[model samples]
Target chain A: MFVSGLGYIIGETFKGLYRNRWMCITSTGVVVVTLLMLGLFMLVNLNIDHITETVKEQVEIVVYIEDQAAQEAVNDLYKQLSEHRQVEEVTYVSSEEHMRRLQMQLGGMLEGYDSALDNPLLASYEIKTVVPESVVELAEEFETYPAVSTVFYGQGYVENLFAVTGVLQYVGMALMLGLAVTAIFLISHTIKLTVMMRRKEIVIMKYVGASNWFIRWPFLMEGLLMGLVGAVVPLVILYYLYQYSIEWVAGNNLYFLSLLPAEPVIRELAKYLIPLGTGLGIIGSTFSIGRFLRV
Target chain B: MVEADNVSMKYNRCKQYALEDVSFSISRGEFVFIVGSSGAGKSTLLKLIIREIKPTAGLMKVFGKDISRLPRRRLPSLRRSIGMVFQDFRLIDDRTVSENVAFALMVTGASRRDIRKKVPHVLGLVGLQEKAKERVCDLSGGEQQRVGLARALVNRPSIIMADEPTGNLDPGTALDIMNLLRSINLSGTTVLVATHNREIVDRFKKRVIYLDQGKLIGDEQKGIYTHVR
Candidate 1:
């Protein structure tokens, strides 16, 4: 009995789709466009997150040591910097190493300062905070140390980068949400039109004792099929697009511009997109057919 | 069997009742006609029997159960036990006659093999066996109503309520539908028809329930259409 009932529902769903093929195709196209925009925005947001994370990792606070500070004071400052809860990692750079780095930067001018006795650069501890936003606060704490001469973490650049990334995340999320609502609205209106066109047939069905579900199953299935196809099309398209973009970036040696790897992004998008698409479809069909079922 | 007692129905915010103090009971195997002028609430009474609308007051029962309070989930079973036909012939025009009939059985969760066997038999009963493959849009008015009848009878319901089943047909075609209904009634399936076709109603000389202005004015065995003043 269940098999035959299922057969009937499947048969009716196909018949409904075939009969209204043009409408189905138009609605499906709408879904495809909506999902494509949504997926694109999602990918952009994901890549932005990756880029910001990499940039944040490069932000380091350098606490310069006073040249006259005693060795024990320097050791105490280093211990304090390491024990701070917000600190992720700290590396000590000897004055000699600092001079060597300076020499590499100003090659010909640093030839006279190669000896440790003549090296004028102060030793420093490079501090990395667990969160980039706390870099300024951590830098201030280091500045209060007696052995620390000064602190620098490129404060202006780091703050501006964080602000921009925060705005990008919010805007991306809002746009995706708007697109999802629009997609649901479009599908719902299309389903409404189909339901209106079949009003008489539904009346007949009701009179002939078709249960609410018997009448509803076909429209629900139609919506589900549309949503599934819509999600799959964009996912396939985005996967290849992202792959090609990644390959192009690698081929051109654009090391500064980071694109997230293709596989994980596509997989994550698929995880959410498929269910969302299908859920929107079901909701649309359910709303459109609700009034007619009261019979 | 069907029964109604003091059943009244009023549309929202409206002072006038669509039906008032209507009382009737139909026994098994009865052929009854509800004859009245337009706006006399004939259709409303039929809709009440089908439980499409609940009576605003008093009690209504069908198949010995109070359907006025029947739960929504159980409505399908109640509706399945009673077949209904409409004035518009309410057939899905794009589908073939056989498909139209099979839809009735399909809704009841009948097997495909049962539908395959039952559809042709019902179509044959309505004398549309040869036209089973023809689309409803291609058929004449009488033929379409016959298809509607075939759909109604396909499920083998004990009661058939038709709201002006012949309303769209010419006099001759209408008479043919009435004759078909009468024959089905003779075979012991209870039939209730709501119509204003005075000529056939008088010619049939069957039990008639007459209504006027939302009130029952006359009911008699072998009654004429104009017996009520």
Candidate 2:
């Protein structure tokens, strides 16, 4: 009984949608635009995560050693750097190893001038901090070490990166929420007009012994189809655009930004956005029909 | 099939009542007329019997069951046993005559085979079988009321309550509808007609319950419209 009734209701809903073709298209268009905005914000979040991972990887402080420091003092400084609370890992490079690294960096120009000229490169401890933002404060602390000559961390760049990401996260969520509510209201308002137009049908149904649920089923189906159309169209367009974005970034070999690969990210996004769009459609239709059902 | 005792309905807390101290009972297969002019609470009485509004005071029953205490879920089944026709005829203008009649059966969970069979039978009873494929909007006023009557009877309810069924028809067409309703009543379906049509009320000479200013002033056996102008 339920299956056949459901089939009938679905057929009726299809008829209703076709009858209200202009409204359906306008409603679907608004839903697509709003969902596209939501998709863009999600992309922003994914890329922000990617950028943070890269920045974290490159966020170590380098402490250069005093050239005339005693061997014992250098050993003590290395031990302290390793044991510091903020230091994640510390590696000590001897002056000879540093000289060899410098020779490699300078290429053949600085090669083969060894012990007689002495190792001019300073020995350093390469430090990785637990938090990228802590690099500056930790670098200052390392400068107080007895054998440390200088501490280097790009403080302004690190602070600005963290600050910008924090603001972006806040603004992205606010815009997404605001736009989502607007979409629901807009879609439901349009559906409300359709419901009003069909009110005579509802009154007739009520008089003829149709249950409230029986009347509601077709409207619910209509809402679901509209939502599916709205969501799927933008999702396909977003999928293609997302693929193009990844390819463009890869083709340019852009050093400033690194996005996660398209295959997993777009596929993962599909798993969430499609259901969300459908849910919003249901919600919108429910809003439209709520008052009418009370009669 | 319906009972009421000292029933009253107040639409507002601070306003006068729509129905006050009204009491009546209706038996199965009894053709009755609730006769009154405008503002006599005739429609309000019907609405109360259908549980459209809870009586502000006293008890009302349908099919020997107290309706004031009936559960919300049970209302549909109660209404299914009693069909309603409105003054406007309330046909879906967009649908064909056949579909309009079939809609009544479909919503009540009738099988497709039953709908196909019964829709034609009821439309034939209303003498609109030839016009089954025509949209209701294309039908004349009398034809449209016949379609409404077809819809009301398709469900085969024990009782049918019509509010001013002939209000939109000419005198000749109104008499034709009255004859159709009388035949249905004779065939053992209870009928309640709420109307201010004086000539039909006088000519039919049926059981009449008269109301004036939300009060039941008289009940007459084979009564005519007795209100003074």
Candidate 3:
């Protein structure tokens, strides 16, 4: 009996779809457009996240030591900088070594200006901090050190990147949510119109004493079928587009965008698209039938 | 058996009454006719028996259960014991005659084996066994009415309520259907038919309840259409 009921429901759904071919096609088309737009937004958002992470990894703070410090004192300052928790790496550049490297790069251009330097440049240790935010605190801490002259890093660029990425993530999430709600409402209303057209059949079923579930199951199944079809076209189109775009990026060596790896992104999209399609279908069918099912 | 005590039904905030202070009882194994012209509350009374509509005031009992207070969820099980036929011959257009007959049993979760055995038997009883494979839309009006009757009788309910079962049929086909209903009643199922066919009333000579303007004006045993011309 259960098997027969299931068969009957499946048969009925197909019969309904065949009878209203144009409406079914139109609803599916709407679903495809909605899902495609959503997929595109998600892809762009994922790439933005990857790019921000890459930028964060490369940002570092540079610390400088005092000019008059002795060689022993400079070595001591280097050890102190290395021992700091926020410091990634530390190196000491002597005044004489720095001058020699500059002269090799600009030998004849700087020959007349050698006597102008009454004082030698400071022999400094270059310290790289692990985190961009820790630069200010490190600079303040280093200022208290007797062998430290000054500390500086790109504070403005770091703050601006964080703010911009934060706003982008918020806007992306809001847009996706709005699109989902609109899709659900549109699909549900379309299915509701279909139910309204066949209300005479529903009334007869009710009079014949069909259970509410029995009356509703076929329509719900129809909605599920609609959702499945709607998701399929967009999913296929988006999947190929993602693959092609990733291949293009890889081929042209556009590494600065730092896009998400293709495999993981595709897997995540599959997880989202299937359920989203099913939910839209089920919700639409339910709303349409619920109006007439009320005894 | 069916009984109604002081039943009254008002609609749209008591501005109009469909059935007013009506009371009657039908015995087991008896064939009863409810006769009246249009707007006489015949359908409203039938709807009350099937629990399709509740009375605004009064008590109705069918098969010893107080149906006036029955929950909506329990109405289906209650209705399974009572068969109803509509004037329009409300057969599912997409279904075959046999499938339509089997639908009543299907809703009650009857086994396919039982449906296979019983559907043919009921179709034969209704004299539509040959046309069982045909779609209802393909059948003539009389044939469609027979299909409706076959569907109504498939479960072997204790009582059958038909509202103008022959309203759309020709005189010859209507008489044939009346004969079929008589045979069904002879098989020990109580029948309540609501119609305004004076010829059928005179021919059947059954107990009749006559109503006018939502009021039961007369009741007679072995009665014909006795209201004034």
Candidate 4:
């Protein structure tokens, strides 16, 4: 009985779709536009997150050791840096290696120090941090350690990068929210037109003793279908567009403007688009039903 | 069964009461008539009994429940037990006779087997069994009214209210419709006909409630219409 009831309601919903052909199409079209914009912004937002992560990876800290530091101090400093949770990677530069690099940088100008018994240059440890912001505290803490001469981690650049990325994430979220809300109202208004056209049928249903839910099911189903269809179309469009754009960028060899892998991004977006579209559509129809379906 | 006690109503448009101090009770298995000229509060009184509109003063009851104060959600249950027929028939033009009859049962949550079983039985009672698949729009007025009757009778309701059921039919078709109502009444379901048809009222010789200027002027058994203008 329940099965038949659902079948009947579904059948009725389709009948209504056919009966109000233009209105259903118009509402579905509105959903398509809304979900498409949502997809576009979501893609942009994800890529921004990816690019910021890449930038964070490039940030590093350099700690110069004093020339008078003993070998035990150098070994101890290497162990301390490795044990810290935020230190992702560390490379040591001996005084001898520093002198060689200096020689390579300035041809034969550094050849005067080639046979010197005591080296004038300092040894250093290059530190890559897991979190970009940790470099500030790491630099301060390193300055307090004995045998550490100086620490420079480009503090100003790291802070500015983080701040800009934080704002972009927030702005992206706000834009998506605004568009979803606008789509809900637009879907609802169009469904309202559909409801108005069916007012007589609703009145007849009331007179014939139809339960409120029984009467409401068909409209709800219609709204759900509209939302699902609307969401799916944009995903298909976005899939092709995203694939083409990703390939276009790869073909141009523009590695600096790193785009996140397209497949996972599309898969991730599908999860949200379907539900978001349907939820908005249902909300719209519910309001329309409330406004027009007066008993 | 239905009862009214000092029921009065005045619509928003006028200070004059549509029905004033009207009191009556309709017993089970009785065929009753509410006779009045146009604007004599016939429709208003019917609307009050159906609880379609509330009476401004006093109480009304149907099936032993205080219907004037019945909550909106409970109204459908009340309405389900009573079948209503309008002068214009009110059948969906696009539906076939079987679909129209089934529509009533479908809304009440009847299974397809039950609807299929009951629709034909009710249509058979109205003598429209052969016209089950025919579209109501394609039928004659008499046939269309029969479809309306079949829709009303599908639920086998305890009471049937026809507000001028014959108002749109020719004399021959009107008489046929009256005969159907009479047969339905004979089967022990209460019937209430609101009409100014003096001929059928006299012929049926049933209990009659007469209204004039929003007041009950007479309640008689086996009575005919007698008020002039």
TM-score of chain B of each: 0.98, 0.97, 0.97, 0.97
Which candidate do you rate higher for TM-score, 2 or 4? 2
Q: lDDT, candidate 2, residue A89?
A: 91
Better of 2 and 3 by lDDT: 2
Best by lDDT: 1
Candidate 1 collision pairs:
none
What TM-score describes the B chain of model 3?
0.97
Candidate 4 lDDT tens digits, A1-295: 6324768888888987886778889889988988898898899888988898888788888899987889899788889988889989999987788878878889988666643587787789989988876888888988888789999888688889888988988898898789767766776677677777777667767766776777888998898899899999999999899889889988999888898887899889989999877876677677777744455
On DockQ, the stronger of 1 and 4 is: 1
Candidate 2, residue A136: how far the Cα is off, in Å: 2.9
Q: Tell me the deviation in Å of residue B54 in model 4.
A: 5.4
Report lDDT (CA) for all predictions: 0.87, 0.82, 0.81, 0.85
Off by over 4 Å in 2: A1-6, A9-22, A52-57, A66-119, A144-147, A250-255, B226-229
- Fnat, model by model in order, equals 0.61, 0.56, 0.26, 0.43
**Native-interface RMSD of candidate 2:** 2.3
In model 3, what lDDT does residue A45 have? 76
Instruction: Give the distance in Å from residue B110's predicted Cα in candidate 2 to where it truly belongs.
Output: 1.3
Interface DockQ of each model? 0.59, 0.52, 0.38, 0.41
Q: Per-residue CA lDDT of candidate 4, range B126-202, in tens?
A: 99999999888999988998988888888889999998999989988999999999999999989999998888888
Backbone clashes, each candidate: 0, 0, 0, 0
Report the number of the highest-TM-score candidate.
1
Residue pairs whose backbone atoms clash in candidate 2: none
Give all TM-scores, in the order shown: 0.93, 0.88, 0.81, 0.79
Report residue A86 deviation for candidate 4 (angstroms). 5.0
